[model samples]
Target: MSIPYQLILTFISGGIICVIAQLLIDLTRLTPARILVLYVSVGVLIYAVGAFDPMKDIFGAGVTVPLIGFGANIAKGVREAVEKEGLLGALTGGLTASSAGITAALLCGLFASVLFKTKSKRM
Candidate 1:
C-alpha cells in the first residue's frame, strides 16, 4: 500500500491498543500493573504462535513500542538462547535480552527525575 495507508494502519493499530487499555482501566477493577502484564503476556503468546511477524511488518513501531513488544523480545531471546545454550537459556535469556532496554529505561527515568520535580497530586 501507500505511505498514507501505512500511517493510518499504524495509528489505528496503536490507538486500538490504547483504547482497550483505557476501557479496561475505566470499566474493570484490574490495576495498571495487571493490564500491563496482560499485554506483555499476550504479546509473548502471539509471538510464540508466529502471529506477530506479519503484523509487525505492517504496524512497525505501533506494534513494537508497547509492553507487548517487550514480551515478544523476551520470548525471541529465550528461543534463541535455548537453541544455543540448552536448558539454562530458559532461565537467563529473557533478562539478558531485555537488559539493555531495562537499563535504558532506568537511565531515562533517572535523568527525568533529576531534571524535574515531582508534584503532589491534589485531590
Candidate 2:
C-alpha cells in the first residue's frame, strides 16, 4: 500500500525528534531513556492543554508518527472519552488509548533481552 502524506510527515517528524534527542545525548550527559521520557511527558502535557490538536490537524499523522506521538494519542483518546463519558473517561481513557506505545516498548525490550546480552559495566 502507498504511504499516506500524513504518515510520511509523521515519520519525518519522528525522525527529526529522535535525531535531535540523539544529538542532545551525544553532547550532554543525559541518557536516551531520559530524553525519551522527557519528550513524551512534554507531548502529553501540551496535548492535555489542547495545543497539540492544531499541530496534528496541520500535519496529520506527521505529528503523531513519532515516539511522542503516543502522548498525543493518549491526549486525543482521553479527550474523546471525556467528551463521551465525562469523569469516567478521565479514569481510563489515557491508558487505554496509549497502550499501543507501552506495548510496543515492552515487546521491544523483551525482544532485545532475548536477542542480546546486556551486562552492566563494573568499574
Please report the candidate that would top lDDT against the real structure.
1
lDDT of 2 at 77: 85
Tell me how many clashing residue pairs each candidate has: 0, 2
- lDDT per residue as tens, model 1, 7-118: 8988999888888998999999779999999998998898899988888999987888888889988888988899999999999889898899999999999999999998
lDDT of 1 at 65: 83
**Candidate 1 segments exceeding 4 Å error:** none
Expressed as tens digits, the lDDT of each residue in 1-123 for candidate 2 is 245766776677667777888888999978978987888787888798888888777666666766567777777788889999998998888899988778999999999999999799999
Error of 1 at 47 (Å): 0.8
What TM-score would you give candidate 2 relative to the actual structure?
Answer: 0.66
Per-model C-alpha lDDT, please?
A: 0.90, 0.80
